[model samples]
Target chain A: MLLALLRRFGQMIFVMFGISVLVFLIFFVTPGADPAARIAGRNASPETLEAVRKSFGFDQPVWVQYLTMMKKLFVTQDLTSFVNRGWKVVPAVLDTIPVTLSLVIGAAILWVVFGMLVGLIAAATRGSWIDKLLMALGLVGCAMPVYWLGEMMNLVSQSRYHDTWLFSWVPPLGYKNLSDDPRGWFLTLVIPWFTLAILYIGLYGRVLRANLIEAMQEDYIRTARAKGLSETRILLRHALRTSLISFVTLFGLDFGALVGGAALLTEVVFGLQGVGKLTYDALQNLDLPVIMTTVIYASFFVVLANALVDVVYILIDPRVRSA
Target chain B: MLEVRDLRISFRTEHGRVQAIDGVSFDVGESEILGVVGESGSGKTISLLAVMGLINDPNARIEGSIKLRGRELVGLEPREMRKLRGREIAMIFQDPMTAMTPVYTIGWQIAEQIMAHEKIGKAAALARAVDLLAEVNIPNPREAIHRFPHQLSGGMRQRAVIAMALSCNPALLIADEPTTALDVTVQAQILDLIRKLRRDHKSAVVFITHDMGVIAEMADRVMVMYSGRIVERGTKAEILLEPRHPYTRALLDSIPPLEGEKPKRLRSIPGSPPSLFDLPKGCSFAPRCPSRFERCAERPALEGGKHAAACFLKVAS
Candidate 1:
């Protein structure tokens, strides 16, 4: 088991290295992406430009620059954004991590709970009107983009229905730190969480439904039935247990990607200053250091998520342990 | 211990209602082993599934009566059936590899079945599960209890399945092709284990298989199903030695001989069972029977002969 874990750790390192190198290559490949002039300000003297270039190591060879950038971004942790002018990109990215984590984690909990319920209900009531309705709702949820949903929610709560009973509790759109005000943070994130979760709820529901239905046909289920298990017991303990394998895999990837700034659309629409939003603003200004920091952070999360999925697989399925 | 009368199970498919089991009936006495033999789609497995009340397909339509210890079972509410299941009636299935939940250890699966029917703590249930595993001849019951289904070999898993079926000491144990997925040597060992279990526990067993040899070895009584109906049934000795129905005779002839000089090529029955979707208007076996005659155009009732055989020739003789 320890050897397997060590192998997984080694694989993660290899993947992170590959992704980091690719991110660096992609950044340099773009024409006119150099940051020296941008760092020195709008119209800078040659001496100042050269000085800024030396400090940032823009004049160094590509490998040396890459190593120096990695050292600043990770080891020393003082990488600065050219667009923000002296703002430490690492700290800024780190600060937004909690906001994204708050939004994604809350949304994950909601989606997982509701999604399993929807899938379980649909599978149990299969071929009935209720099943059809749930499936249709799930499809609609998947089809409706998160940005549109977030904006629509914002319009209803903030402008159109703020005076109504339902919307009266709606706070102004923006994130609050939990440390600053726990209740305010909860209130600020409630809508964004739902908006972000809606798409995945539909997605996980459909996937889980299909998996549950397939699992219901397995020979073990027949044994379960013949063993005289109650319908609920059979569904929950036997069928649903096996069906969760695929659900966990899907959740791991989606959860990781969302926390890694893939929630940019929802973040932008809801006015949350998350890592996604940070990456989005940095992109428009072509902030090199911030992009680099966010890219590596995002890759770290994705690789880490896949590793976590393996661990979850070992828990939910014994067959994976030997492999 | 068990009686099934006029059992008919059909399914509503896109084409039409397919008669998967058509008017099959049989009885099993306490501690008796009744072997059901047939080709694939012969309704052997379906009849047993119906007996266990495990046929949950929405498209299925089941009719007739199943009586366990003189109590009506057909149409019993699922909740009531659950109480009877595992406790009064348990089932072992083909392909033990797939019959046990993959995620759980063999001991856990066995203990879960025990707990499902009895009011026992987890530790007691687990202890009983270990004893059950040891009874089935699984080596190192202490350590083996922690092994998952996939970790065990085919024979070991099948033994574990049998242990689970026996956990509640059910009055009736239904085994559907339990040895079909096993190799020849393991098949013999499992057969021996099952025989020992019935002898020791005195639980009536309905063992379903397509192998004549397995029936010869394990059955006191043998029932041969063709298509969706039983064509022949008698003492194991009677059916194997003097099969009267043409279908039964063909099945017997198809078996590779052990004593006589080997044939240049092994004999095989021609054609397959008729589809339930569009059955011929006569004996289901007639289309495949080499001795099919005029009387076979209409279904012959199971009658005449020392035992029962559903063939016009047997009736006339």
Candidate 2:
């Protein structure tokens, strides 16, 4: 067990390192992605571009330049944005880390809870009208894009229904720190959280319901019935418990990408300065340092989520341990 | 200890209503082993499922009387059925590899069974589970309980299933094709264990299988089912020695000849069993029977006392 965990940790580090290097190589080696050329004015003289390159150490050998960038990113943490003058890339990304985390974590919790609820209800009432209705709703939720849903939500809650009792409690669109204003943080993010979770709730519900309904027909379920367990006990203890193995895996996979800036559209729709938004801004300006850091950070989250999924799988399924 | 009469289970599918079980009836006394033998789709397992209150298909319509210890089982509320299950009647399903919840350790599964019917503490129930495992001849019972079902061999998992079934010392123990999925050697070991369990617990057993040879060794009375009806039933001696039904004869003839005799081409009954949706009005086996007669157009009811066969030739004779 210890060895497996250690191996997983090593794999995470390897992945992050590979991603960092790949992004670095792409930025420096790609034609016209040169850092100094990107920072210099577009119509600058060749001498002016050469001067910029020398000042930024881009004239050094590629490996030396890569080391310098890594040191600036990790050790001194003073890497500046190329397009946005005087903007320190690392601190800006770091400052927005909690915002992304707050958004993704809240949405994840909502999705998982409501997703399982939808799945359980659908499975229990399978083949009935209620089941069909939930399934159709889930499909609709899945098909609706986050940006579109977010805009629809904001339109109804912030403008059309602002004075109505239903959405009157809606807070202004923006980000709030949980430590500074717990209630405001919750109020501000609730709509965005729902908007972000809608897709997953639908997807996860359909997936989990399918798994749980199939699990009901398993021989173990028959054994459970013969053993005289209550329907609730059988569903919760045997069916749901086993079904969650796959559900947990799916959640882990989605959670990683969401935290890794898959929530960019949701962040943008709500005007939250999250990693996704930061990455989007960096991409617009071709900010090499911010792009590199965000790439490493996103890969780290994805790999970390995968590792956590493996751990959860081990806990949920004894059979997985030996494998 | 158990009585079932005119039990019928039909399902309303999109195609038509399929009568899976038609007027099946049987009884099991204390310390008795009633072997129910039939091939796949014979309704033997379906009948047992109905009796166990495990039939959950919403399209199914069940009708008949099933009394256990004189308590009416038909129409018993699910809650009441839940209470009676595992305590009064426990079942050992076919395919032990799939019969157990794969994620849990064998110990927790067994303990869950015991704890379900009683208010005992978990530790106490788990301890009893280990003892039950030992009783079923599982090696290293203590450690075996901690292992997942997949960690154990097929035979060992079946043994664990049997151990779970016997956890409550149920009055009626139903083993449904429990040995069909095991190796020949493992089959014999499971049979021996089931026999020992019956003697030790004095529980009435309903052993369901398609293998007549297994029926010979495990049953006191044998019931032969074909297409949702009992084609023949009698004492083990009567069914094996003086089998009356042509289907039963065909089944017996199909068993491979014993050693020391010259090897010969094996005989098997031709034509698969009919579908539940489109069963003929005549005897289900009439079309396939060698001695089918003109009167076979009309279905023949099972006739005789102590020994019975649903065939005109046998009744006329």
Candidate 3:
């Protein structure tokens, strides 16, 4: 186990290095790209541009510039954003990490719980009307776009029926710090959570339902039933146990992507200043330092998520250990 | 003891209704082994699945009587049937490699069965599981209990499955091709284990397989099934030594003798069994029977006797 963890850690470092090189080349080494001029801002004096270029080492060789940028980002930790003068890229990302983690983690929990519940119910009642109805509802949720869904949710709770009893307790757009006020944080993020989770709940529910149905047909499931275990016991303890492997794999990818700024649409619609929103603003302003850091940060989550998934995969399936 | 009378099973598919098992009846006496021999598609596995109340297909229809100790089990609800499973009746399946859940330890699975009906403490159940492993002659029972299904060899897995089936001392044990997937040597060993388990537990056993050699070696009585119907049944010696029904004779002829003049070619019954769908109007085996005559065009009744054969020729005599 320790060896596997160490190997995964090495892989994570390699992947981060590769992504950083790619981002650096695109911003600094690409033809016609001028970080010096961009940092100096539009219609700057030649003296100001030269000063910025020299100070930031943009006038140095490509490798030297890359090394200097790495030192600023990692060692000195003062890689300021070109668009926002006072904003340090690393600290900017760190500050928004909690907001993104809250949104993604809450939505992940909601989706997993509801998805498994819906999937289990659908599988149990497979050919009945209950199965059909649940699956159809899941399909509808999966088909709806995240941005559209978030807007619709806001329209209903924040404007259309803000004074009504149904949405009276709804909070305005924006995120709250959980450490400052736990209840307020929860209430504030609840709608965004549902909006973000709705699509996944459907997609995961359908996938889980299919997986469970297939697992139920396995020879071991018949053995479970022959053992006199109740259908519930057989379904949960035997069928679902094996079925969760695929679910976990899918979750790792989805969770990592969301934390890496795939939740930008939801954050923009809900007015939450998450890493996704931060990345969106950086992209709009062509902020190279901020974009480079966010890209590397996102790759870290993706790589880490995959490593965690592998560990979980071995935990649930013994056959993999021997293999 | 177990008694099945006029038991029929039909399945509805997109094409039409298929009569999978047609009016089959048999009894398993206490401490006796009844070997059910049949070729594939003869409902060998389906019949036992029905008996175990494990057939949950929505399109399947089951009728007639299944009585365990004179209590009707044919119409029993799934909830009530669950109470009898593992304790009153236990089943071992065909593929030992896939028989047990792969995630759990073999010992945990056995303990699950023991606790399913016994209300025993976890420690006692686990101790009993270890004892069962030892009873099945597994080496290092203590270590084997913690191993997963894939870690064990094929023969060991079969033994573990058998150990689990006998954990609760069930009165009726149904083994469906329990050794079919094993090597010839492993097959012999599994058959011997079943025989020993029968003697030890005093449980009536229904051994289902297509290997006639296994039937002869393991069964006290044998029943031959063709196209989901019983074609012949008698004492093992009576059937093996002097078979009556042409199908049974054909089945016996197909067995290559260990010591004898080697035939130019091994005997095999010509043609496959009739499909459950689009079955012939008369005898289902008439198309494939070498001795088929004019009377064979009509259905033959399964007559009652110490040795019964479902053939018009036998009835005429």
TM-score of each: 0.95, 0.95, 0.97
Clashes of each: 0, 0, 0
**Candidate 1 residues B9-70, lDDT tens each?**
99999998898888888899989999999999899988888877888888999999999999
lDDT of 1 by residue, A264-283 (tens): 99989988999999988888
How far residue A83's Cα lies from its native spot in candidate 3, in Å, is 2.5
Q: What lDDT is reached at residue A71 by model 1?
A: 91
**Per-residue lDDT tens digits of candidate 3, residues A69-164?**
788888999998877777788988998999999999999999999999999999999989999999999999999999999999999999999999
TM-score of 2: 0.95
Name model 1 segments beyond 4 Å from true: A1-8, A29-57
After superposing candidate 2 on the true structure, give the runs of residues whose Cα lies further than 4 Å from its correct spot: A31-37, A163-169, B315-317
Which rank order by TM-score, best down to worst?
A: 3, 2, 1
**If ranked by DockQ, best first, what sequence of candidates would result?**
2, 1, 3
Q: Candidate 2 chain A: minimum summed lDDT over ten consecutive residues — where?
A: A32-41
- What's the true lDDT of residue A222 in model 1? 85
Under CAPRI classification, how is model 1 graded? high
